[model samples]
Each structure stands twice: as structure tokens, then as C-alpha cells.
Target chain A: MAKRTGQVRAITLKQVAEAAGVHASTVSRALNPATRSMVVPEVVDRVLAAANALGYRPNLLAAGLRTGRSHLIGALVPDIANTVFSPILSGASDRLASDGYSIVVADVGTNPARHLELANQLVARRIDGFILATVSRDDPVVDFCLDQHLPAVLVNRAEERRRISAVVSDDALGMQLAVDHLVELGHARIGHLAGPETISTGFLRRKGFYDALEVHGLPAGDYPCEAAAAYNREEGAKAARRLLDAAPGITAIVAANDLLALGAYDVAAERGLSVPGDLSIVGHNDMPLVDMVAPPLTTVRISHREIGRAAADLLLQQLTGGESSTRNVVLAPALIVRGSTAPPRAQSRLRNQQRGAG
Target chain B: MAKRTGQVRAITLKQVAEAAGVHASTVSRALNPATRSMVVPEVVDRVLAAANALGYRPNLLAAGLRTGRSHLIGALVPDIANTVFSPILSGASDRLASDGYSIVVADVGTNPARHLELANQLVARRIDGFILATVSRDDPVVDFCLDQHLPAVLVNRAEERRRISAVVSDDALGMQLAVDHLVELGHARIGHLAGPETISTGFLRRKGFYDALEVHGLPAGDYPCEAAAAYNREEGAKAARRLLDAAPGITAIVAANDLLALGAYDVAAERGLSVPGDLSIVGHNDMPLVDMVAPPLTTVRISHREIGRAAADLLLQQLTGGESSTRNVVLAPALIVRGSTAPPRAQSRLRNQQRGAG
Candidate 1:
């Protein structure tokens, strides 16, 4: 292969050193923020001025080799195109930027093997740490990080074992809030459109749904739950079909994700059941554009951006403090009431009948 | 400062060479796909087997230093949360991944200075090339790339000078389609919600709207156009309000972006005017969830993923072919007709009157 070279040569430290009338070693020390204190104030200012005048850009790759710190964080997400992950990435990136740490985002997709392969690639590229938003309930990538003793922080999702710091929403509280709203609206036969059980969010949210049902004095067996293979609209539609077919007379559904809930909306439309009129549905995440969907979405809103920021903070803490203790930061979720949910049609009809009798 | 280190020792090439009973240089040559041809097939097979057995991960950074190729591409986007850019990133990433290139995505936001700073940082990190989706009509970043002799490809937006390769949707054709659809529906008094003219998309789409109006035999002077300061929903809302207020008889609007069109939707809601009943709105980009929005958006569908893939291809061509010729790949856009547009109320009334007389 031919040697790859830029047409215009980059201004180097030697050039800055010569211009500043200082040794190359002194120039390097003065330029680095961490080592600037070792140099005299006047010399540092002179070096800075010379570097600025020359338009000298430091090669961070060489600096990384010398210091053994890349200042690059690798963020692995399941799907970059998903609306739910976007705000999280944005939030994490903003917080990391303030700390002078650049994030390298990798969309690992849904393949478990690909996740490990990408993570290894990032490690090979010398990323200082990882912010993983793609962890499963029992992920191999989590074990790989642990075995490698790499600094990693989980975002949006967590491993079953708290081996590393994680920032996520209170999944159970979100489910409770969804169930409480449905129960108050007199929806007894509420089904669940569950996500894939392999993932942490799906597993915990499904568990939370059952737990919420018990709290509401509703029988778990009475309300059937179907788990989607993935957290996409297509999988959600298939799962919703099975759930509806198995459990007739279902008045409402609580989906583990917004995409799945949208899938349920598709199923409802296909069955000629108007949302809130025939089959009221509630979704989680309250992802972008859910509020604008037909009949809008009554969903549990997780602070995804906050989760991202918190994840970055936790990773930074690990990098700076070198503390080994694992901490789980769980943010609270709120229910966003919209046009997708209302009192069940049966209950509304009963109220009208009672009013007529009175 | 303390040296950062992973607890587990990585498998070294020396160990792999020892296991394969070959010299370290031979092992290295056998390992690199580009240099494997230098070694005999048997020796290469032995080295590969030993490396695989030892679970040895190659340090790409070290290899990059020697080869002057990181196989890493930096993609700078204006906003990570924008749904339009997500698919573009994903498509570019997927295509690049097949060629052993990993993309480092930096969300530079809307700040022009930040774009340059991030580009400089990526250059400092020795990225092989850049895929910039943040270029304005006369972007300094474009000039910076030219001055630095960096291989860069523009996506979604382009510079007027055409110094680098770009993959963009035919912005004028998109506007013509939107306007033609509305004109076919008997919309004569059409207004425009223009994006910031500083950006190429905003400028081209706005100019296209007026050009389309002229082609449809409507006077451009009669159509009031308000340009937003940004592509965001808030800016779009402000521009839409001014456009509606300035042009009282406008029955239809062509917005520069989906967010702008949604902003028009907000203004219509505030005025208690039903969509397609009191006002018709058309959006550009046909962004994610626009199809699900209440009175689903009628808009132009730019193949963003295709544009992204094409951008990656152009950048790769620059890298592998070492070509200097600038190319602009303009993909065609289709109009997505939905519930957000219809005939003017006055035109519908006239049709009713004619039917009654008949």
C-alpha cells in the first residue's frame, strides 16, 4: 500500500518549541493541561502563544500512547435509529464533552456476538472506558469487561449482576404507575405486550408488570402476556396478535416499550378497534413522536437523557476516583397522560346505564 | 498523574509468535490482512491459529501508527437526536463496517465553532477521513478540509464551492414535488415556512418553493415566506406564526423541514383550525414518526440512508483510489401524501355550489 500522507504538513511541537525559544520537552509539558503546572507561568504563556500563532495541533494519538489515556469513551447502543436511545446518547455526549472526553458511539445492533466483537475493537482502539447501553440480562460483554478489568458503565439497561456502575430508570415504578392508571380507569382485563426476556429492560419490566397486577388485586392468570422477540414495531405486532388471540375481552394493554405499543396500535387498527374507544393502550419510554401519534400515546416517560448523563458521570467517577464499589443510580419515571387511554368502554357504558336507572 | 492500566494482561504478539514457532516480525506480517501476502500460506495459517487460540487482540492504534491508517472515520452531525440524521448515520456506519472502518460520531450541535473544534480534535486523533453532515452553504469547515488536505465527504448538506464530494437529496426536486401535489389539490394561495438560509438545505428548498410556484402559474410575490433562525421546532413555530399572520388567505404551506411542518401544526392547533380543514401543511424530510403524527404529515421522502451509504462510498473512493475529483451524488425524492393536506375550503365550497347548480 502507498504511504498515506496529507499534502500540507501539520505544525509540530518542534516548530512550536523553536518559535517559543524553549526545549521540545518543555513545549510538550507546557501544552498538556495536566503537566502545565510543572512549567513556569511565563514560559507556559509564551509556548501557548507560539502554538496558537503557528496553528499547531497536538496529535492526541501519540499523547495517548505516552500517557496511557486515550480520553475516548466507547458507547455501545443496540440500535442507533431507535428514538429512545438518541436522547440518551446526546445527553451522555454533552456531559462527556464538558469533561474533555470524546465518546465513540457504536451501534452494535441486536446481535450478541457483534456486541462483543465491537467492544473488543473499541478496546483495541484504546478507548479509556465504555458506556454500554446494550447489555442483556446475562450478557457475555459484561463478563468480558469484568474479566478484562475495564472501566464500564451501563446506561438505560443493566446486567443482572451489579458488577459495574449503572444508571437506569426505575422499571418497577414505571410499571406500577402504568398499572395504577389503568386500574383507576376500571380496566381489569389489561394484557401486556412484553419485550424480549433476554434483555434487562424487558425482563424487569415484565416482572414489574406481574408485580403491579398483584398489587392491584388482579389475577395474573386472567391477563395473558406475550413477549416480543425484539423491541421493534414488527415484533410488538406479532406479540400483540398472540396476546389478543389468547386473551379475549381485553380492554387495555401495557407495552414494555413504545415501539411495541405502536405495534399494538397497528394490531388494534387492523382489528377495527379504535384506540381508547375499544382497546386502550399504555406504553413505556414515551419516546419522541409518541405524543403526536394518532390518539397520541398515554405512556410512562423515562428520563432517558438524565440516565445518559448519570451513566457518563458514573464512568467519569470510575476513571477519576478509581473506586471499585459498584453503584446503581435509578431515576424515577412519570406517567404522561394523553388521548391513548381512557375509562374502558364497558365501564363507561355501565356508568351511563346506572345514570339512566337513577 | 497515575498511569491508567487494565488489570488483565493482554495476549502479546510475542507469545503468539512463540506458540507458532515463528519470529515476531513474521507473526506481525501474517496477522495483518494487508501484509499476509508477504508470508507463506502455512506460516500465516500457523500464526493465525496461535493468535486465535491465545485470544490475542491486535492493537489497532499501534498498527495505525506504523501504517498511517487508522481505518477510523469521523462523522460530524449537527444533532444526534434529530430522527432524519439517525438513519443516515446508521446506513453510513453499516456500509463502512463492511470495509473494516469504524465511525466515530460527534454531535457538534448547531454551533459553527464547535464543528471546527470537533473536526480539529478528530484530525488530532488521526482519523482517516471525515463524513461531515454539518456543512453550511459556505462552511469554513469545508475550506479547512481543503487546506488540511483531509479526505472529506458531505452528507445531507453541501458547500456551494463543491471542493469535496457530497451525497445530498435533490432539494429542489423535493420542493417541486411538494408544491405540485398541493397545486394538484387546487391550493393557489400557498405560503412557505423556510429554514435558516445560511444552510444549503434551507436555501435550496426555499428557492425551490418559489420556483415551483412560478412553474404552477402562481405569482411568487403573492406567497409570503418566513425563514426560521434554526431547523428546530421552536424556530419553525415562530416562522410559521409569522407566515400565517402575514399571509391571511394562504390555504396551504410548504415547510423546509418536518419539524417546521409540525410547528405549523402547532400554530393551526392554537388557532383552533383543524388540519386539512382550515389549513394544509406539507413537510420535507418525511422524518421518523411523521407518518404516525396526528393528521400524519404530507411531505417529501428523501432517501437519507441511501445518501449516507453514498457518502461513505465517496469517502472510501477518495481513500482507496486517491482521487481528487469532486463528485455530487444527488438522489431523487418522492412525495408522501398523507392526511395533512387537502383542497382549500373555498375551492371545496365552489365545487359544492357547482354540484348544486347542476
Candidate 2:
């Protein structure tokens, strides 16, 4: 084989050893998390500190080729246009690239019937592993990966069975954040605009909303709930329109995703209702540019990039660490209060009326 | 070598021959564009039509391996979250995947120095070709591809010398659409929020703006212009602030891209000016959710998906047909009028004052 010499010469094990005043083999053992305890703790810490200071990254390509592995990973995203996946992909790709692996990306558009077929194609091509962002609640792709003993990690969404390793944002916690924010603003009759139930995000966030409302002493049955066919502004608007028409007294709406929340804004416009005045809206997944929308949406911000990095780490572990544990890392979600959420109109109206009478 | 049978059975030459009622050899000759003229046009047309109708995708992987190719392509996107490149990538990937090729993606972040280094890494891994969306006006990657005799295509950007095959929007025409729309709205004093000068889109779009002004019989230098350091909302807001500060009399602003136009919206909000009431704004690249923003943006719409498809076609031709024409396919752009643009506030104010006097 021709010499693979196109990449820049990365810092080597010998350099790290020289910096740490140790033998190269000793440095390697200390750097390996599993074998670090074999060496003295002080030497391991010194080696790790030296490696970090010098930006030493292990070259996994040469080592994997001997085992007939390509040292390449495949990432499957449902829709490339969906803003939520880009940050996750970026995070994952960046993490994997640092470890000398390149990601082959595939986007399975709305009709997910082709998901398994494409996964099989990539698997047949000898991809070392996969990081899937397109897994449905019960996915054939997941089942195929299990049957083949393929190393894969699910990101953003996970299967109900939990048969594979996954790194996902706390969907239940994200919805809880959205609901608590609206409830604190005195919105008792808040509606939930859920996403499609086939995806884990939609199912878990919907359940989370009801659970959160019950925790706050608000009856879940009092609030209207509607599910969007997809996570887009058009479907979101359609769902929002139906929910508002059905529950004329609902003062606020909690959207399962940012796109659906944008749809709610359109519905509010069509009805000539002012945002945060007549209708308060809280969106999940603080996607890029949502803060720049008309009312500057209040949203639950999930660390999508962190989730991507964590998923990449898990997949790398499965591939190189000889560790078979199926780990699920859940990142926390925070509430970002922008210009979209506020006190319900009824409360503000009563306060205004009292001031006028005074 | 082991017989590679990982790919599913695609439509065979026998199927096309059966559909076209021709000999297998004749069908093969007709399918190869270079050898099609050997067979009569009547038979060639029939075979081509049958191939299209039956969704007959050629198994390029099997043929490519004979020449020691991996049947893989590399796509380099500058920023994954930009929204502009997703459609392009989807188009390219869909086109390539149909031909039995997979795309390996890499994101070159703000620092572009590592572009060639990473490109070399993919090349060392034996990527058959590349579709680069991160090329600057004088990029080293272009020179590298030229030196190595590699198959590559540029999308949404081009080199200053046009040394490689590129699929770009008609930047000059897009600017013409924006400027003419504003000119027809009776705006004599229009400002421009330009993108970074280093990128081809920024450089060409800025030139297009001035050329468009000249065509509309408007003085170019009479209008204020500020260039953003990047194609992002924050830089756009900063540039918009400077332009507004420099020319308080300007009634309309033309942003080079949607993000910049969004920044102008921020400036308007800060100045207590209503869109189309105090200032009219026009943006290029009508990205998703721009229409959902307050005073939905009136902008130039580039067919990004079509551009992607065209780039893929060009790359495929170079790879299979052994053709190396340095073609630059420029697609036409359309102007989408929304609530963001209207007659200048000065004109509207004069009309209102006339009605009052009468």
C-alpha cells in the first residue's frame, strides 16, 4: 500500500513521553483509561497533563487497518434541512474527526421506509460503526444492527426497548421546562403541540408535558393537546390552528419543537392575536434563528452539540475500547426566556382593570 | 479478489434490452453516452427512455472497483448550520447515491487553514472525488486538486479564475432582482449590507449590487454600503448599524444574504422603525423561516437544490464519462416579494401629507 501521508504529522506517543519524562510504552499505558490504574496514579496524571498541554491525539487509523476495519463511521440524519440535526452532526463529526475517523452522512427524507435498506448498504460497505439520528420508536434499522452485531449509537432519539447505546437530550425534562415556565406565568389552560408519536422526542415530550402539569397541581385534562404530523412550520401551524379552535379559552401553547412553535406564531397572526399578550408560546429545542423570529421565542435549549459529541464518544468506545456496555447519556435542558412568553391576557387584563378602578 | 456483492441488484442491461426490444450489446452501447452514436438514434432514444422510466441506476461501484476506486465522494461544508448548503448537499448526495456512491462529509470551521490538510486526509483514504462548498476566491484546495488531477466540483462558490467545474447561482442576476425590485418601489437612496470580501459569494454579490444600481440608472456611490465580516446574523447586525449610522436618510437596505437581512431587522427594531413603514429591506437566499419572521422578508430565491443536482451531474460526468470540461453552470434566481418591502417611507409620508392638505 502507498504511504498514507496527506495528513499533518500529529503529536506522537514519543513526544508525550519526552514531555512527561517517561518511556513511550509507559506513556501509552498511562494514557489508556483502562490500564491507567496499572501504573502509579501520579505518573498517569502527569502523562495525561502532558498529553493535554501538547494536544496529543491518538492515531486510530493505522491500528484499525490491521483488523480489516475501515476506521470510518456513518451518520444517518432524517432531514438535512432540519436545523436541529446540524449542531448534533457538527458535534459528532468534530469529535470523530479528532480521533482520525471520517463520517459518511446519509439523510433519509420523510418517507423512512428506505431507512433499513440504506443502513444495510452502508453496513455491507464495511463501515466500522454508525451514529443514527433517524431512529423511530421501533426501528427496523436498530433490529438489523442488533442482529448483525454492528456497533451503532443513537442520537437525539432512542428506541423504547433500549437495545443500543444512545446519547439524547432529556426530552421529558425539555418539555417540563417549557411547561413550568408557562405555568409560572399563570397560564393554567396551556395547550401542548406535540410532534409525531413515532419518534422518541415526540412521545417522551408529550408525556413529559402532562407529567409536568400534574406536578404543578394543574389538571392535564383541562389543557388541550394536539400533535403535529411533522416537525415543520406548516404542520405546526395546522396543529396550532386546530388546538386553538377546539380550546377557545387556552391562554398559552407549548410546542414540542421550535418549528412547531413557529407555526403557532402564524396561527396567532391569522387570528390577529398578539404574542405574549393574547397568547404565550414556549418552544422546545432552541434552534438557530428562533431567537430572531417576530416575538423572539421563549424555548427549552437542549445541548444538541454535546449530545452529538457524547454519541460519537460512545460509538468510539464500542469500536476501540473492547467495552460492550450499552450506555445511555442524557444531557440536561434549560429554559431560555426570550420575548415570546409572559403573563396570560386574562391576568394582565384584571390587573389593568383594578388599576383603572383605583 | 473476492466477488463484491454487498450492493443490491440494480436494473440490468438485459432488462433495458427487453424493455427497448434491442440486443444487449446495442443497449449497452446506447447507454454509454460516448458510444451511443454507434447505434441508431431511434434505438438509443428508446433505450434511454426505458432506463429512465424503470429507475435503472447503474452499479457504478462494481465498475469503479476495477480501477481501484472506493466509489466514495467527499463533501466539505463550511458551516453545517448555515441552512443554505443542506439543500445543495441533499441534492448532491441523492444524485450520487442513486449512482451507488456514498458521501463522506467534513465541516471546515472558521479557521480555513486546515482545509487542504483535511482534504489530503480524505484523498489519502481514496475518495474518488469531492464537492467543495468552502472554497475562497483563491483557495489552495483548488490548486491541490489541479495538481493531483483529482475529480472535484464547487457549489455555491467559484474560484476567481474559474479553474474548476462549479455550480453557482447567478449572483449578478440575483442582485439585479433585489435592486430592481427596490428601485421599482421608488427608493432613490438604497443601502447595501455586503458579506465578507474573501468569499466568492461576497465579492461577486457586492459587485453585482453596484452593477445592478448602474443598470437601474441609480448612482452607486450615493448609497451607503457596509460589508459584514461573516455571513451570520451578528455580523449582519453590526454592518447594518454602521450603514444606518452613516446614512440616516436611506429608506431601503439590500442585504447580500438572509442572515444579514435579519440583522437589518434588528437594527430597525432598535431604531423604533417599522418595516415597510419606515424602511424597506430585501435579502438574498430566501432560507427557511425567513417568511415566518415579522414582516416576512422579500428576498431573492436561489434554487439551491437544483444547483446541488447540477454540481453532482458535473462531478459524475467527470468521473464516469472521462470528460474534463471546466463548465460553470449558472442557474437563474427569482425575486420573492413579501411584507418586508414596500414604497419608501418618504414617498408614503408625502402621499399622506398631500391627502391631509387636500
Candidate 3:
């Protein structure tokens, strides 16, 4: 049983050897990647010629039939077209493809709350395990997969109770980068447009922002934090407006995603306030659309692709009979300064001038 | 002989009947979409409830095994982001999914021109047939599949030799609509930006334009045509420039696709010309991104979803042993008038002034 995306059945070495009238061991030696040296050169040539003629496909299922050895790991993304998932999926797919592994991708839109269904599919087909990007902290899918002793890894999410393998970008480092960049430009009052608390990334990222604010010794009341129900354009804009209205003294904003940052831009344009002049803004994810959206948002650029690749690697390791040793690999985030961030407005300069005169 | 993606084994009607504690015939009636209602109401409920409880997966392969009617088909698309194929794919998926048949989709970018490899995969797994959206006019994959006797259907492409089932949009009606629209707008000199000749669409659409022009009693020289290498933005711009440069008197252009029309936008912008004021453009494929671009395009909209549904129906008929007859379904296209098209840039007014002065 050779399981690939297309419908090609695999031919076993035993079948190939029998068809070629060669000893199984001789056929094995001829086909082995490492040991074809001891066989007679002419015999090896003849065996290969016959094998090719017979269309003897490599029996992947028979080779990796055991648990922790199936060599197939899955990656579940919420959406394929949102651009943020594109590089991540491509990276994981490319890395795994070279290792003779295939990613069985299922989009959440096509299969809603797909973990249980996908898990059932993978388990029935003897797929080694999975790399889930769309995991909730208290997800039933995570609990079920872990309960079965299935080798699995989480991407972009860290399970609170289930200590499985994970590859996440340092959102704390990202927040620090955002805050430090703003401080360097002499902005005092800052606000954060946080994402939904249901997901781990959103919860942890918001916590990181508050922690950073405390570390900077800024007045907590001065910097308001508005929690959005989701990390999307409309939610971001709604959060940004509320954050701005609540914290009237705020000079900069830290958005949860690029889409959020764009939403903030809309709010600013509505109020007739210029970005970086009236407000300094920063966004995360740095999706492809943000670069073309006028001001080119200042943001923390994380390697979403590297995160996906690392997740696949961890899942593959687990699939290859490795012990269920819990591990979390965190990639660092880099601050990319575009046109969205700068010094606080001239109103602050006038206040400073008044203070100097006094 | 288990099929139905990601499933374990084929569940039988006996199992469903035994679990439901009902007659096998009753279970069969409940499962069959056509006769499902004929079963006793309580018996049907019991069978369905029991089947869901037991996860009674119908092995599409096992069902097809005895009857040789596996309702599995592979769909190949060149690009996913291209709006032209999105509706078609979605439509096919919907139509196939309703009949307990699931489509195995392969985005060609992941494995370009590896249709042989894909075909072999499908063949190994017992794919009954295929619906290919990316078939070229003279494709090798077509020849290979024909030789192997794999049931196949083409969408948007008609084989020049006409050996396979195909579903195409009426390019002649579309061309006539564009030509008549331009002529009614008082434009005597018009041109066409034709798509690649290698594709059946490109060839037929260009031919349709010639046929429509002759029927409309327009001189051949009055409407020149430039062939585009592909249905893309850059190609449209290049083709537009060539048409404009060759026939300076031409005021209206009929573009092969929306992306090409966008390219014409770039050309008009470069030449400091306003759309509808200096030049009139008509696009095709009314894709998602086209409406988002500055000036919404005027084009003929083809029903991609309908084409996909029709192809699925045709393939399903063959798989179910219903017929061996070849099918050719040509759907009609509708003309949309948006912001991009207008009376040909006051050419008649300018011409009238010239005559009056003389």
C-alpha cells in the first residue's frame, strides 16, 4: 500500500524479485541505496532493467508500517489563501518532500474543527502523526491524539496541559522589539490592540505586551489594552479606535497582526490623522498585502516558513520512533522599520517647549 | 478496496442493517439518495443514527469493486489563486461531494507537468476518471491518458481532434457582445488583445472575433488583433501596446482576461490617458481582483461553476455505467458593462470637426 496524493500502487521488493527470477536478497542488494557493490554488475543491471519494465514502485507503506515510523506528518492551516500560511506551507512541504515524506494538508474552511476527523483519517491510514497549526489550548483534538500515544507536534500554538512538540516564534521578543523601537523614537504613551484570548498565540502575545510595559516602568493606566474577539481587519480597526479613544494621550500602537494594523490605518484616515505624525504604529505577520497598502507598515517580521519547517521536522522525528520528549523551538523575530513609525506629534514638542520656559 | 478519502474500510449494508436491527433492503433504501425516502421513516432513522454512531464508512472502492463504479475523480488546476478556476473547482467539489464522491485535487504548481506521475497515483488508487482544467490544446498528458484508457473530461479546452468530453463557454457570443458593444458606442476602429494561441480558448476566441466582425459588416483592417502569450497582467499590457502602436486610430480594445485589462490600465497610466475618455477597454473572466482594481473592468462573464458541475455530471454518468456517449456542453456567457468601457474617446466629434473645418 503506497499512499501518495495520486493513485499509484506500490510494488514490493519481494514481488519485483519474484518477477525478475532473482533471489530476494540479490534484488534487495541491487535496489538498496547503500549496498549494490557485492552483486555482479551485469546481474544488477539486468535486475534494474526488469524492475523498471515491471513498474515496480517502492512500497512505502510496508517499509514504514509501524507506529512512530510512518514518515507522514500533517500540517493543518486555517486558510491557504490568507498569504501568511503560503510561505509556511511551502517551506514545510519542500523540506518534507526532500525527506521522502508528504504533507496531508487539510484546510479548516474545507473541514471545520477538523482535528478529530483528520486524526481518524491519519490513524486509519497508519500515518505517523501530525503538525497542527490550528490548535486551541484546550482542544479536544490535541487531547484525543495525545491519548492514543500518537506522535504529534503543534505549530503556532503551545498546549497548556499537553506537553507535546512545538515550534513557535517568540512573540515576547516581537513585543520588546516593537516597544523598544517606539521608545527609541521618544514615544511615552503606547497602546496595544490585542487578539482573541481563546488561542495561545493571541493570549501569550497580549501577556508579553503587558509584561513589556511593566518592565519599561510606564504607567499601566496610561497605556490601554483593547482585546479583540479575533485577529482580523475589522476587529483590529475596532480595537484600535477603542484603544485610541480610551487612551487619548497614546502616541503609538502595537497591533496583533498586519491586517489589524491596516484596520488602524482606516481608523486614522477616518479621523484625518497622519500615521507616524499623529501616531506610530506596528503590526505583526507582515502579510504580502501590507507592503502595498500605501505607508508600508512598520512591523516585527517573523519567519512563518521556518516555524512551519521546524514543526514538520519535529513531527518527522517523532514519527521515526523517537520518544515523546516534549520540546519547544522558538524562532526570534526581527524589527522591520517601514514608514509607519516615527517621533510623537509636534503637540508633544510644544508641551516640552512650555516645560522648558517654565 | 477502501476509497472515500482518509477512510479505513468499506462498510456494508449488512452491517448497517444489523446495527439498525432492520432488514438489509430497508438499509439500502435509506442509503440510496433516489429511493432513500421509500424506506419506513423509523427504520430509515434507525439506520442513519446507527451508521453515524458506528462511523460506518462506505468504502467507495468496495462499492465500486463489484460494479466497477468507483466515483472518484482527480481534478488538476494550474493555479489556485487564479479567480477563473476557483469557482469551477468549488462547483465541481460541491457537485461531486453531494453524491458520496470526493475530488482528489492537485494544484499543479506543487508538481508542474507531472500529470503522468499524478495519473499513475490516481490509477494505483482506483480513480475512475479525471476532470482537468489545465489541459493544453496539444497536451502529452491527454495522449498518455487516452492510451491508458483512463476516463477523462476537459474544461475550458476542446481537443482539436474532438476525442474527449469537454465543457466550454460560448466564446463566439462573448466576442460578438464585445464587438457589438464597441460598434454601438460609435467606434469604427476596434482591436482585440487575444490570449495564447496554444490554448483552445485563445484560438477559438480570436476566431470568434473575426467571425463576429464579418457578420457585423466591419472591414478586417478596421479591427486589428495582437496575440498574448498568456492570460496575465503583463501580457495584456504588452499586447495592448502592440495594438495601440500598430493601429493608432483604434479606440476600443477587447482584452482576453481581467489581468490583461489591468495591464492595459498600466499602459493607459503610462501614456497619460484616462480610461473611457482616451481609450475604451473590455476584459474577460470578471475575476475577484479585477473589481478591486482602480477602475472596475467591463467584460463577458463565463459560468465557471456551471462548467465544473456539468463536467462532474458527465464523468459521474460514465462512472455509474449510465452511458459511453461523448458529450460537448457549451454554456452561454453574459456581458457586463462597468466603469472601463465607453464611446471611443470622442473620435467622431474630432472627425466631424476636421470635416467641418475643411
Give the candidate number with the greatest DockQ: 1
**Residue pairs with clashing backbones, model 3:** A6-B121, A7-B121, A7-B122, A7-B124, A7-B125, A8-B121, A68-A319
- Model 3's chain A TM-score stands at 0.86
Candidate 1 residue spans exceeding 4 A from truth? A1-7, A347-358, B1-5, B347-358
Please provide, for model 2 over A1-358, each residue's C-alpha lDDT reduced to its tens digit, 9 standing for 90 to 100.
6422222335778999999999998998998787787899999999999999987765433333334467778888887656788778888889999987888888877567889778867764567888889847877788877766788899987666777889888888888888878888888899999999987888889999888888889875787899999888899999999998888678899999899999999888777677888789999888877887889999999878898899999988888885677878989999999999888876553454355456
Please write out the lDDT profile of model 3 over residues B1-358, one tens digit for every residue: 5331222333566888899998877877797778987987888788899888877655333444444444556766675445566567667756775665655554455344675675565454455688888845777667766666667888888766777788889888898898888888887777888999877788888888898888879897786999988887788889888987888777778887777777777787666666776678888876643442445678888888888899888877766664656778889998988878888755642454355456
- Over the stretch B50-119, how does candidate 1's per-residue lDDT look in tens digits? 9999999877777776677888899898887778888888889888888888888788987888888988
Per-model C-alpha lDDT, please?
0.86, 0.82, 0.72
Chain A TM-score for model 2, please?
Answer: 0.79
Chain B TM, every candidate: 0.92, 0.80, 0.82
How many clashes (backbone atoms < 3 Å, residues ≥3 apart in a chain or on different chains) does model 2 have? 0
Per-residue CA lDDT of model 2 for B93-140, tens digit only, reads 888989878888888876778898788777756678889998478778
lDDT of 1 by residue, A79-191 (tens): 77778787888889889988878888788987888988999988888888999888577777788888788999988776666778889999999999999999999889989
DockQ for every model comes to: 0.61, 0.21, 0.10
TM-score: which candidate is best?
Answer: 1
The local lDDT score (0 to 100) that residue B253 gets in candidate 3 is: 83
